[model samples]
Target: MKENLTDSAYAAGWALVKRLPEPVATRLFDGIADFVWRRRGKSVLRLESNLRRVRPEATDAEITALTRAGMRSYMRYWCESFRMSTWSRERVLASFEPEDVHRLDEAMASGRGAVLALPHMGNWDLAGAWVVVRGMPFTTVAERLKPEKLFDRFVAYREGLGMEVLPLTGGAGTLGKLAQRLRAGGLVCLVGDRDLSASGVPVEFLGEAARMPAGPAALAAQTGAALLPVTLWYDGTPVMKGRVHEEVPAPAEGSKREKVAAMTQAMADVWGEGVRAHPGDWHMLQRFWLADLEPRPEESVLPDPQGVQ
Candidate 1:
């Protein structure tokens, strides 16, 4: 499993992006989206399969249109992440409506420490960066990218924006840090809708069973953290729109699995409301439900959040 080729490809792509201006980046992304949509290869096939899984009743033409929209959304996220350094704080804050900020404020002021759960729906990196600019730093978990160079580069970029990325390494790395922050009344944001790691708990989504990461729910149960689902949608606007759900009730007095399942359902309900409002903004590019068919034989050593890191 040599990752040199993958690393090289991404590095080259990012290098080209690093040199582009905002307007040029937008145009380049639009072009890339057009190119990806016109193709009928693995990328298109995977997108079509995911669309069918999520929206089975959609017509073939409807699925194709959704795939194109997903591709564009995905590209827009990448482009925006690269351009984050160039964005002014005023521009970033202006991206969200005042009502959205009000909901987030209400959730955070609950004093239980808000866990902003986002999906792969929109520009989440940008969303987190926006919070940082607004003077509220948050903790989010990310699986380390392959090739140490790329991983370090991403960490540097994110940390520069006041985010503390917890890497999914063995023992007290990311998750341990997350618990400490939450207990101390810090904001913890996680993307709970998709389990990119391929190891997650099965939950009903969009009227079908889909697997999502159990970490957010598990953390909520372990600690009395408030879980809030947040999503951003483009909606043909230069500045995107955002939605936020109030802090969900954490199932603390239940069995671990039951509590996690309840929390997962709460998260699913929040995300479902957002997706229904902006179906075109949902950006899952690969198959999600079928990943359970794949085995997760190797379990990593996860640290106890109660233990001090």
Candidate 2:
């Protein structure tokens, strides 16, 4: 029963929100963010906790203000997502402003394929859409949302945007499928910041020990693809901004496991820099550090991110 309501809510969001005027929809989502921020719900408090680590020197009042800004940024992501399906190609291209995109071009030109590892700092879906518009349709893995139907909705939505979506679990062969795409000179984008599976490569992130998914690093090492870390953020306008960091190279003379670990740690360091540079745009509103998750080991590990990317 609860699952049905959750699915219906998202269904309504896609159906109705897309039809509203741009300014009206923006104001509506901003209002919703403020309301939730004022309530200081579990999600809000969790965001506060995570932000403290990001800005360790912040005073209480500053943290409070930061959290509110973070909530607004998060709500902006949702607003952009709900209406992305309705966006035209020109709009999609115009909205995303990323630096060093030639890296993607060079990687693909090498015919070894490329893997874009992105943090949940901004609307990654928009970035993906921008890529698709440039004629490079990529494949991505999605963590299955509960109430099965909601997950299906997400898949269809991304597919509609010219992406090939794979399930994170219970797919025909997730790792093999990704490798096949890479060897064919195709692109794969993965959310690298969060580890849905607890068994992940350990790394120090944001000044604490945290586990980050090794898929990006592993895929790059196995297929000889370029491993590029991309961080995104909103720059207080409708335009979304991002950067493509230099690719992480596999360490010389290391076992596959060692190489993966080193690459993942490098990726984590890049992510920490991105988050610090734009803390509010990072939509991390859940437990992230090892110490934070130790006591609540069995809690839901899935991020409250509106889009899995």
Give the whole-model CA lDDT for all candidates, comma-separated.
Answer: 0.71, 0.87
After superposition, which runs of candidate 2 have C-alpha atoms over 4 Å from their true positions?
A: 294-309
The TM-score leader among the candidates is: 2
TM-score of 2: 0.96
Q: Extract clashing residue pairs from model 2.
A: none
Candidate 1 lDDT tens digits, 50-127: 677667788989888887887787788777776676667887887755235676676567766777888877777778
Steric clash count of candidate 1: 0
lDDT of candidate 2 over 210-263, digit per residue (tens): 888888999999998999999999888889999989999988879999999999
Query: Could you give the C-alpha RMSD of every candidate to the true structure, in order shown?
Result: 5.4, 1.9
Instruction: Report how far residue 295 has shifted in candidate 1, in Å.
Output: 8.3
Q: List the residue pairs that clash in candidate 1.
A: none
